[model samples]
Target: MNMNRTVLYKAALPIVMVLICAPYKVNAYNIEDAIKAVQLNNNGIKASKENVNIAKTERAQAYTTLLPSINLSNANTRTTYDVPQVLPNSSSGDRRSTSLEVYQALFEGGASLFRIDAAKHHLKAVQSDHQSQVQEIVFKAMEAYERLVVIKTVYDFHVKNEEAMQQHLNGVEARFKVGEATVTEVAQARASFEIAKANKNVSSGEITALEASYESITGEKAPQNMDPVDISGVYIPSSLDELMQICLKDNASIVALSSSIESARGNTRVAYSGLAPKVIGAINVNATNIKRNSPYKQDGTTYMIKVNMPLFNQGGIEYVKIKEAKHRERKQKAALESQKSAIISAAVGIWTKYSSSHSTIASMAEAVKASEIALKGTIEESKVGTKTITDVLEAETKHLDTKIKHTQAIQEQLLAVFQMHQIMGTNLSMFTNTRPIVQTAFNKS
Candidate 1:
């Protein structure tokens, strides 16, 4: 008897362990917390922020051209002289000198001035780029979050459907045993259960794939049973014209491109400044020992300013540099226009999706309801020998299809709202609480 009991215990242990662990496995992460965590931890976003900081440092350096460059020098030399033994004692002679020099560029044609402007503009562009990164990372998290939700919903639905298919197959098999259902009906019911089992497996696989994506963004295991997203603040503009205008004024990509153009123009001016005359001023202060044996010292100060003009370039290098900058400016201008066009197209596409998803969700909701009622009626009628097993299975399949479609529509609607925010360049606000220290986009300013 003890041996029999041990065998039973060993047979049941795996199932018991699975039961104990399953309930504790799911972790539900808050969406806001995930967004904040990604912002703080994501490596790419951190790198872009560093780029902004670098731009700020360059801006300060650009201002240094307006300041003088100072140099300090000190030199000490010692010489030892040995007298003959009959003569006096050996002596050491030392000489010390100190000098300070300052050189100030009173003028750099206008290169320094243009560089200062270029630095600020480039900083502005970098700031825009940083904001864009913040938006992108947040959107990735949101996308993964929403997709996980949809996958979980569908996965749960498939689980339930599979259970129902199993029950139906059991009932048909029992009826075949009682000689009430044909062998063909039993086979058909068993075939439907196998398909349902396959569907459940597919949904389970999708849930796992989505969880991996979710973890990659938020660095956490996906939380199950996420509450529906609350997009109460999302809205579409009344007309395409309004959206286009808003995008033109506020989109970060366009803002960055505009800043790049301004920076390129400043660079061109800096190159032009190289061809202009320059003025420089210098001052020198020197102190030196008058003699090695004497304790006297001499100190003198000199000051001078000079004007310099460039007569020619050896290989037209300066002119070519200006031309290169101008070409970059043109490219930036063209890119800005292209970005605007793309934004307009995206707005139209999202609007269409958002509008269509509204209809689809509603239509699918009704279809699911109708299919559920039909399924119930078909099952009842089949039990009375009126509806075939095939009819009942078809209705079950239709119901499941409608339910999955409805969930997909919901996912699309959610993503479309986010896409609208992305298009309008307001997505950063949705994820981050702290505003930028310096506003880059003119519209935001």
Candidate 2:
């Protein structure tokens, strides 16, 4: 019993130690699950959310500026003079003073109101940017998912092709033993088998890398049997004009840049307001307490109206900012134009790719069928000595290549459809059957 216990402990110890040291395994994620996890956990999305919060607070602060301002202050001092101060007759054990001041802005040449507007616009821009970031992350997750699925499918075919080549090699060797096949034929078959093995090994390595990439993006391991998204039945725009119209309303980049332009215009108005004087209403109350001899007193409240004019601060102050704001507005407008151009270009490119992939897939499908039939016929002929061993092997390799190309065409078509959806700024919520993952931006009345 002691010996048996020792053996079991030895066997279990490594497993226990490994479990303790190994990295914690995350749960598997499907497409929708992966996007949700990213929204919750991705570091970039986290930072972008923080930016939205900052924008929200800044906008609130802008609104606060339109309200009254109040301040409270106090001061205390203890002094002991070797000789009693005579002129003012002030000899203090402790002198305490408190003041309350209020400054209400009656007017600021509309700069404050414009600043508030600018802050609000900036907030909107950042919110839109955050949404764009979410979409980008979703697109990346989808790409990773597709890559892993397609590559795995490719890997499976390579494995089967390798097996087929191995069988062919064995047949060729048997024929050579019977003097029915030449040594060169056997050598060729062996070489083809090795090449297929190398291809399978290479694809295996690709699968490992793709799996890691998928995990890194989704924050979890992918499931073994991933149901690939079939975008074929998804909506496709009828024409480029329809796509352009949708893009005009839905593209996040254009929306963000347009908001930025409005913000810049507001800031420009604010900068020009510096040329006018600011009217402020102010009041202050003073309360002071001296020693027991003096007691405490409350001074009368002082009320005053103050006007502050911007004198001069060279060219570095409001003047430069006004000019800079104008230039910035122009720059942003140019950027928006450029972005629209790029969006159109991308939409056209994807549409073309998807359109072509349809025919490419059909053609490749036919090629695969013909090659399969040719391989079978060639194999029969080779067994009957009417065809050389080399012809049969060549036909088999051609069939495998044709089938791989057909699969690749299918993958491209699917990805093109997904790409079209992404480029058109389709709501990310559409990716799931459940509730939407992203909020749709609404136009204000």
Candidate 3:
């Protein structure tokens, strides 16, 4: 039995060794996943969804105005003395009655229809608003994700720089001991090393803060491994004019304002309805007994057609309301135009930044390459006693700065593209294939 157990242990030894030695594959968290998480967990998105529901309920209530109203009532009364009854063949005594009535509006100058239209348009406006809010939150998440990546890159650069500086300081100290370097040179190298160390620490702190921010936005702990963002799949129009046209047509904020204008116009029509005559039709069925003890009862059915003409309101309030509604409609129109202009301006600015950053990346990349070559050459020259340590240190610093700037330029370009998506109201659909959370009944066009 002991021999069999030894043989079993030996058989499993290779498998255990492989398991311990092999690298574990960590799944990379990506921008698409981050966006999906934020959409599901964000409080702002949940609130916006609630607003859409409220608008839907308001729209349903508006449609109910066109339907008939019904009421049923019953009453019982007693008197000390006998009372005469108005209806024929009714005894004089206590009375009990029950009524069923229904009222329907036949016409009010299309006021009911106008109210329905207004509600419909208002629903569209809120839906657009919700879309806009979603885009804003998405942009924020992208911003945070990109910023975290850049900071991480910067932190890595700082760590490398610190290592390089430490090596240089060690060489300087060795040279000083050999009577080949001065005390001032040694101090300078030490100072540069300290600076690099401080920068690394600062970047490390930024990473912690950014990770917390990511958690706050996504309601998930930030992943240790994150895939680099890929912006190549995102599409952008070449010409500024074409992009602007798209923005005007598809931007959620602009769409919302346009819907608001239409809603306001509908409300104005509803206010004008107050000047027209209103027609209503009502039906009533009632049963009454004048004496509770008596078996005799009277039943009646009544039909009514009522018309109310506005000769003059009590204080000309209808006319004032009409004027106020018109003013509100005009205000909405003005606001729409202003929003359009603002969106155009923003589009132009982001386009400019994207163009600049796109060009800057190429130039900065070349600068980094040149700085690397220069630093190498300077270090070689200093080793032969032809160049000073100061020159080598300067080149090293320049190379590091160039690398950082190149990273920043790349981040800026990516962010500008995302901002364009935000302006075009397409960010929500850019990365995912899921259906929209809020939908409106009206056609987008």
Give the Cα lDDT of each candidate. Answer: 0.82, 0.82, 0.87
lDDT of 3 by residue, 17-62 (tens): 9999999987688787889888989899999999999999989998
Worst 10 residues of 2 by lDDT: 436-445
Q: What 10-residue stretch in candidate 1 is worst by lDDT?
A: 432-441
lDDT of 1 by residue, 281-311 (tens): 9999999884546676889999999998887
Clashing pairs in 2: none
Model 1 stretches astray by more than 4 angstroms: 1-28, 79-93, 292-296, 429-445
TM per model? 0.86, 0.85, 0.89
The alpha-carbon lDDT assigned to residue 135 of candidate 3 equals 89
Clashing pairs in 3: none
Candidate order (lDDT) = 3, 1, 2
Clashing pairs for model 1 are 27-223
Which candidate comes out best when scored by TM-score? 3
Model 2: CA > 4 A from native: 1-29, 77-95, 289-298, 314-316, 433-445
Model 2, 1-445: lDDT tens per residue?
A: 9999999999999999999999996644456776776667678888889999999999998889799889999998888755445545544477788999998998888988998999999998898888778778878888788777788888998899899999999998997899877889889999999999999999999988988887787677777876665553466778778777767778877788889899999989999988779999999998887774566655668999999888886754988889999999999899989999998998889889988998999999999999999999998898778998779878978998998899889888877766676766776646752343232232212
Q: Is candidate 1 or candidate 2 better by TM-score?
A: 1
